[model samples]
Target chain A: MIEARGLTKRYGGKVAVDNLSFTVRPGVVTGFLGPNGAGKSTTMRMILGLDRPTRGTVLVDGRRYRDLASPARHVGALLESRAIHTGRSAQDHLLALAHTHGIPRRRVDEVIDLVGLRDVARKRAGGFSLGMGQRLGIASAMLGDPGTLVLDEPVNGLDPEGVRWIRDLLRGLAAEGRTILLSSHLMSEMAMTATNLIVVGRGRLIQETSVEEFVRGASGNRVHVRSPQAGELAELAAREGATVTYSAALAGASSAAAASTFEGAPGSEADAIEVAGLPSERIGELARAYGIALYELTPRLASLEEAFMDITRDAVEFNTAAPATSEGTR
Target chain B: MNETHDRQSRDRAPAASALPTPAAAASSRQPGTATLERGASARSRRGSAAARAGDAPSGAIAGDVTQARVMRSEWTKLRSLRSTQWTMGLAVLLLIGLALPLCVSASENWTVADVQAGSQDPVYQSLAGLLLAQVAVGVLGVLTMTGEYATGMIRATLGLVPRRLPVLWAKAAVLAGVTFVAMLVASLVSFLIGQAILGSHDVGVSLSSDGAARAILGAAFYLTAIALLGLTLGALIRHTAGAVTALLGAVLGLPLIFSMFGERLESAQRYLPALLGNAISSTSPARLTDLVSPGRAFVMLCLYIAVLGAASAYVLTRRDV
Candidate 1:
């Protein structure tokens, strides 16, 4: 288990990680989700004691990482793939690290085979591809048979097959009652592999929740309806305790005159409404009672990617302005 | 905590069931399961040993990171690099190779003025190659520390041993120990060969002669001291080109720069590393009045190393990796 409390790291004038706190428990993979410059790497460094926090404490299994005896045996970390010396061979690199804690040479060979790097184990690491470098990093992390694995961007350079392999590897390690903390900028990847997420934006915690709850909470049971009398149906749904909004394309044209013209209009393709806090079945029934010709009634569960973007939009470090045409309608 | 655990278990069930195919494929295609099993067995053995110890609250294992282990790790790292072999080999070569020419020419052109002026003191003349060989040894020492920073390997190294001082101490110990041994052998071989050549001209001194053994051994000691200075500078500067420049400027350039000031800085010149090294390695009676005693020069070199070592240790622990 890993615990970070009031973890703050400031580089000169800029604060990288600000008062961040979280707990990573055993038996599950916790996805550290953030934007590109949201201090995920810095926070991980602080946890591993690579960088000293400005004012905070990060403990692994109730002790500071430096204070832990044989820290590699308890917490194995792969901070960056390029941490190995380029001139050293993969086998020798792992052996050098293993020698620190007196891990046997046999263990080094085992990890080399485990990571599927046996073919290039004796070649200089400088010549390995990015995927191979990541494999070597993982191999070194596993050399101590650690119980806690902290991996930063583990899938950055892997092929599709290698990505699948990492997912399975993390799952298997977590299944063995180990704590696995993996960081990524993509929510779709975490949606597949991680059970819990600690989302950060602009060096601050935005939310910490289970993936199911985050998806469910962000989706909010929204329903989508397309109809000839969409404007009237929107008014009815809004009056019935559902928050109704016109779709971006149709919102500009949803005046009273257009609503009246759309009523009984057979081929009005641009009339649609998004109804939150109501199910599609309820919206369909309401449309039938109002005699509105319902064209499409579909329950829309927001994609995890969209949910992540919506929550972190303001906190995005390099946000671009919305298009001028859509700005007035939204 | 209990609620979190319950939620975790509930969450893990679906995740575990969702990836049956990939997990099975991974195991079938790779040596995944057996490796994990072996890891589990090793962990169990370590866990049992920790339990038996009963004294370590942090589950300290038997072979946890120690000074000795770090030293051993440093030895592996030092020997595994091809640069280490090249730099050390070059140092030995220059130590003995350059000595041959200097000793041959000095013996062949021996004259009455050279003997009167004490320029033909066989011990100092034979060990003249130390000037160039010290450069190679110093470069090796600087690379020992700066190589990690240049390649981004310091992260892996510091992560392995979070209590970082042991790494610095181990590097120092290993470099000092190895350089001392190698340079000593080179010095001995150079001294013996140079003396044999000088003996043909009836100007050679035996090992038992006054100050002869001291001069030979002192050359190795002076070179060892230069290696430590290189390491200390490397730690302080951390960049390869910058640290090497700083090391060379201090060791070789200081003496030349001081010479341009004439007799105004004559007293200060003797404290420079190059001058101190020359004093320790020279047995010429004619230059005795201008140079410090060998013992005093040795003490001054130690003082320099001690101060630099303390600064390095202080900076190493406080700075972030």
Candidate 2:
């Protein structure tokens, strides 16, 4: 378990991680979510005691990281893939780290094999691709088989198969009752792997919630209904305390093209109404009672990505005024 | 790309199967306890004998970050790098190789005017290679610490040993120990070979002669101190080119620049590293009134190391990785 209280880090005058407080419990993967420059990496560094906090403190397993008896035995961290010396071979790098805690040479070999780096373990890390470097970093983290794993952007450069492998590996480690703190900007990935999330924006805590609640709360329950009588159904749903909006094509046809093209396009297109603040069941019941023939009724649950975008929209640091393109006009 | 993917997938097949067995075994063993801790304790209970025999189960041995372990780790780190080997090899070569020509020339040019002016110290002449060798050893020391910073390896290192100070101390200890042993051997060999060449002209100093042994040992000590200074500067500056430049400026530049002052800064010149090194490695006692004694020069060099070491320790612990 890790607990950080009022953790603040300021580099010169610019605050990197502002007064942030959170708890990461054992037996589950806690995703640390933030945008670029939102201080996720800095927070992880502070937790591992690599960077000193400007104020407050962070404790790993109820003790400061530096105070832990065997720090690697308690917490294993992969701060970055390029943390290894480029001139040194992967095996020698792990061996040197293992030697620090008297971890045996066999354990180093085991981690090397576990990470599927046995083939290139003796090669210089300078020659490694980003994925291989990431694997080596994970191998070093697993050398001690610690109870807690702190991985930042573990799946950054991974292929689909490698991404799945990491997800499974993190889940398996969590199943063994280990606390896993994973940081990433990929919300869909977090939705699949993380059960709880601690999201930050501009170095401050925006939300600490479960994956299910965060998604459900950010986007209210919405139902979509397609019918010949979308106009009448929209009014009935609004009277029942539901906010309703017609689909763009239907709204356009009803406003300007209703009299001119209504008879021409009759039965050719189905008018759809999007109902919010009401469940699909309630909308179906209301539609049936009103005698409005509903051609289709479907519940639209917002994806985690949409929810993340909605909540962090104001928190994004680099807001582009227009879509960026590579072309430059003279 | 497709072929590499196929190869990587084939490589990952066995790894995927191999990973879950340990997790399952760990969960079955105690559920929440760290698997490695249990394995380490079991291995410890099984005794170091089995561990030493290399037949203990594939598990981590119970250990914490200690000074000795960090020193061993630093030793492994130093020895495993190609740069360490190259730099140290260059140092030893310069220590011995450059002395040969200087000794040959000195023996050939030995004149009564040199003896009359009392400026010719055969011991110091044979050890002339130290002037170049010290730079090699000093660069090695700077690279030892700065390399970690240059490669972003300092984060991994500090993460492993969060106490921080042990790493600096260990690097210093390892560099000092390796340099002392290597340079001592090189110094001894160079002195012997140079003395052999000098003996051709009947101007050689024996090991039994006054200050001869001190000069030989002092050369090694001075180089070792130079290595430590380089390491300290590396820690303070944390950039290879910058730290190396600073080290060169202190060891070589200060003495030259001070000599140009000529009598006005003569007292200050005696304390320069190069002058101190010359004083420590010279055979004769008090050749000049302003020159420090070999013993005092040794102590002064150590004082420089101590002050820089303290500064490095402070910055190391207090700074972000």
Candidate 3:
């Protein structure tokens, strides 16, 4: 387990990580999420004691990282993929680290095979591709089989299969009671892999919540309903404790799935009202109670991507407008 | 915040499958607990049991990062690099190769007038290649630390042993040991071969001759000290080109710049590493008149190593990687 209390890092006048305090407990994958300039990487470094905190302390298993007898066996971190001598072979690089703490030579070969780098174990690290370099880094982190694993962008340069492989590896390790903290900007990947999320924006904590709550809390539950008596249905839904907003041609203007779902319906061109804080089934039941003809009632559950965007909207460091293009440009 | 607490509590529930396997956990013993050579660093700690708390986690027995293990790791690192072999080979070659031509030319030009007039010190001729060979050994020393920073391997290295200073210490120890052994052999071979050629003219100093053995051993110490200085500069600079340049300037440039001012800076010239090196290998009293004795020069070199070595360690612990 890793606990950081009031961890702060500042370079010159610019703060990288500001008063960040969090606990990474074993048995779950904690996703560290942030925008490009956020302090996820800096926080990880501080936890590993690579970069000293400007103020505050980080502990691995209730002690400073430097105080640990064998830091690698308590906390194994993959800070950068290419953090190996390019001129040395993969086996030699791992062996060099393994030699520290007197870890046996067999364990070196074991981690090499564990990361699926056996084929290229003897090849120079400089020649390894990005995926191979990442594998080597993972092997290095797992060399000591520490209780805590901190990885920064483990899937940055991975293929689909490699990404899936890493996801499974992280889950399996977490299932085995390891504290796995990984950072990534990919919302979909985190949604699939992370159990809990520690979201940050511009070096400050935005929210720390489970993946399920993060999505459910950010975007309110909204339901879209179409009816032949659109005006009356809207009034009834509004009166029944649901905020309703009417839309025309929303079927074509919104998602394509929403448009296709109501195609060729009896009230396909009828007016529709978007109801918030109400389930689709309740809307359907209300229409039935009022004896109103309902064409469609679709509940729009917000995706994790939308939730991330909503929470980080104000925290984004670089905001850009859409570039203007001349009409004649192909 | 309440939800976060709730989620954290839920996460705390024991994960049966996630727990470390009994076998793998059992292998996590304190690093040197299995070995008898517990290393000087282990005993230096306040209490081994208290430090071992972080290493032992009930079923898990993590290894301890003893200084001995770090030294072994440093040896592995230094030996595994292809550049180590190339540069060390170049140093050995320069030491012996340049010594042969210098001895042969000195012997051909040797006359009673040159020897009686004390124009050329035979030991100096035999070890003249040290000036050129130092560059090779010094660059290797610089690369030992800068290569890690250049490749970003220092993060992984420091992460493994976060005390950070031990890494620097182990590096210095390894470089000193390697350079001493290798350069000693090189110095011996160069001296013997150069003496064999000079022996034909009866101008060669035997191993038993006054100051001859000291000069040869002193040259070895001088080169080893140069390598140590390289390691220190590498740590201080943390950049390959900058550290190498700084090391070169201290060893060669400072002495040349000091000598160019002639008598004005004569008092300070003897303290420079290169001038001290010159004093270490020169056996003639005439040459010693302008500089301190070899013993004083050895002490001066030690002072340089201690001061720079401590400064490097200080910056290592205080600075961010």
Candidate 4:
């Protein structure tokens, strides 16, 4: 189990990681989703005890990382793939880390094979491609047979096959009841692999929810409606607690124009129409009240990226929080 | 799937410690909180547990990353580096292979009367290679620590071993060991070759000889000390060009530069590393006991290394990676 309670880190006047808190429980892959420079790497570094938290603390298995005996055995972290020395071979690097905790060299070989780095384990890390470097990093992380794995952007430089392999590997590890916290900029990857997500923006926790709940919550469930009176309908919809957009109006107008031009059949892009935020039934009632015929009414569920953007557009501002304020009150 | 089975122990933050305080803390928080009630309840739950564990003294560092392990790791890292091998090889070849031979032939070609007129002291005269060999040793020493920073390997090194002092200490330990060994071998080789070339003059100095042993031994110690000073400077600078410039300037530059400033400059110049190093290798059975002895020079060398090493440790431990 990995838990961070009010963890914060600061660099000069910049708050690299704000007052953030969350738990990554075992038996599930908790995806750490954030925009670029959103403190994902900083948070991971703090968890591994590489960067000290200015305030609060992160614990792996009921103890701070440095406090744990054989820290690698308790928590395996790959904060950056470039952490390995380029002069050493893949196997040598893993062997050296494994030796630190009395872990057998056999485990090093096993991980190399596991990561499909066996083909190049003996070759200098200097010669390996970025994908190979990531594989070597993953191999080293697994060398200690750690209980909690923290991987930051593990799929950053992998091939399509390598990406799929890692997805399956994460699932397998979580299935075995290990705590897995992986960070990624890719929302689609997180959607496929994560059971739980702790979304962060500008170093503060935005939301921590199950994938299903987060997607649904951010989606907001507003249906799209169109009319020539889109501004009026949007204002009406906004007052009614529904979010509306201009794209739906364009869709409705395109449909209206298509019907007029081609034998009473509506195309998807009729012009001179407004898109309303109300449900289809409600839009019909309102359209009838306004005496404006509805050209198009479509139920739209926002994509994960859209929801992500909507939430984080407000969140990036938190990245500019005072360094002193970032130090967790906890 | 089996979340409940992974029940972890109570651990919150380093700030929390003990049961009574935890109980008090839990109660201290408003039982019925306002808007943040959910997060508040979770905090109380975990904070109380953390207090209990922390109140009891935390266990010793897991595996206890002792100075020994750090030293071993540093030794392995330093020795395994290709730079370490290349530099050590350079020190030996330049000091023993090239400089010793050049000086040996130069002294051999000189007439007996001319040699006697030209020489100030045999102890200083026999160890001419010491001057030339220092460059190689200094270069080797500087690279021992700064090379990691240059290659961006310092990040990986610090990540594996987070405690900064240990990493610095380990590098110093390895530097001392490697420099000592290489300096020792180079000194012995230079000594024998110098003696071989001086065969006709019959000013033979053997390792078994009394005053001969001290000069030979002192020369070895002096070179090693000079190298360590370079290592310390490299660590302090943490940049390859900066370290090399500083080290060379300290050893060779100061003396030559000071000589140009006349006797007044040369008088204070004795305090420089090479002067103190020369004081160490200076030999005379009766006179050695007085003036600047090998013992004093060795201590002075240690003092230099200690001050620089301490500076490296302090800066390293405090700076964020």
* Candidate No. with top TM-score: 2
Give, for candidate 4 chain A, the lowest lDDT window spanning 10 residues. A265-274
- What tens-digit string does per-residue lDDT give for candidate 2 at B1-321? 222211221222122234644344334443223433433343234233433435423433436899999999999999999999988899899989988999999889886456335567778877878999999999999999999999989998999899999999999999999999998898989999998998888777788877888988889999999999999999999999999999999998888898898999998889888888898888754374557999999999999999999999999999898
- Error at A221, model 3, angstroms: 5.2
Runs with alpha carbons beyond 4 Å of true place in candidate 3: A226-230, A235-273, A276-298, A317-330, B1-61, B112-119
- Model 4 C-alpha lDDT per residue in residues B61-162, reported as the tens digit of each score: 124445666676666666556667777787777666664555566565655554344343444556757787788778878877776677555755665566
Q: For model 1 chain B, give the 10-residue run with minimal summed lDDT.
A: B6-15
Give the TM-scores of the predictions, in the order they appear.
0.84, 0.85, 0.84, 0.77
Better of 2 and 4 by TM-score: 2
- Proportion of native contacts found in each model? 0.46, 0.54, 0.52, 0.11
Better of 1 and 2 by TM-score: 2
Q: What digit string (tens of lDDT, one per residue) describes model 1 on residues B1-321? A: 433322222222222233344557466432334434533543344434423444422222225898888898899889888888998999999989987898888888886467557876788878888999998989999999999989878988998899999999999999999998998899989999988988888777788988888988899999999999999899899998998899899988989999999999999999998888888988887776788999999999999999999999998888887
- Per-residue lDDT tens digits for candidate 4, residues A1-330, read 888999988886777788899999776788998887789999998887777899999887778876654566566677654777677677777766655555556566667767777788878888999899888887767655666899999999988878876776766555445678999888888877777889998788999997767766664455655545555555555676666554523443464443343334333433233233456677667667767556666766666777687778755554355534434432
C-alpha positional error of residue A317 in candidate 4 after TM-score superposition, expressed in Å: 7.7
lDDT, residue B64, model 1: 82
TM-score winner between 3 and 4, please give it: 3
Positional deviation of residue B232's Cα in model 2 after best superposition, in angstroms: 0.9
Tell me each candidate's RMSD, in Å, in order.
Answer: 7.1, 8.7, 9.4, 10.1
Give the alpha carbon lDDT tens digit for every residue of B1-321 in model 3.
222222232233222223233334224322222211222222233234344445432433236898889899999899999999998899999999999999999899897466555666888789889999899999999999999999999998898888887899899999989998898899989999998998899778788877888998899899999988999999999998999999999988998899899999999988999989989988877788888999999999999999999999999998888
Of 1 and 2, the candidate ahead on DockQ is 1
Docking class of 4: incorrect
* Cα-based lDDT for every prediction: 0.80, 0.80, 0.79, 0.67
**Candidate 2, A1-330: lDDT as tens digits:** 889999999887667788999999766788998777788999999998989999999988778998976788778888854789999999999999999999888778878877778899999999998888888998888876776799999988888767766777776666545678999877778987887899887788999998777887665557888887777777778898988876556445554555333324335456777898887888889878978788899887778788788788776723233212201110
Top-lDDT structure, candidate number: 2
How close to the true structure is residue B273 of candidate 4, measured as C-alpha lDDT? 82
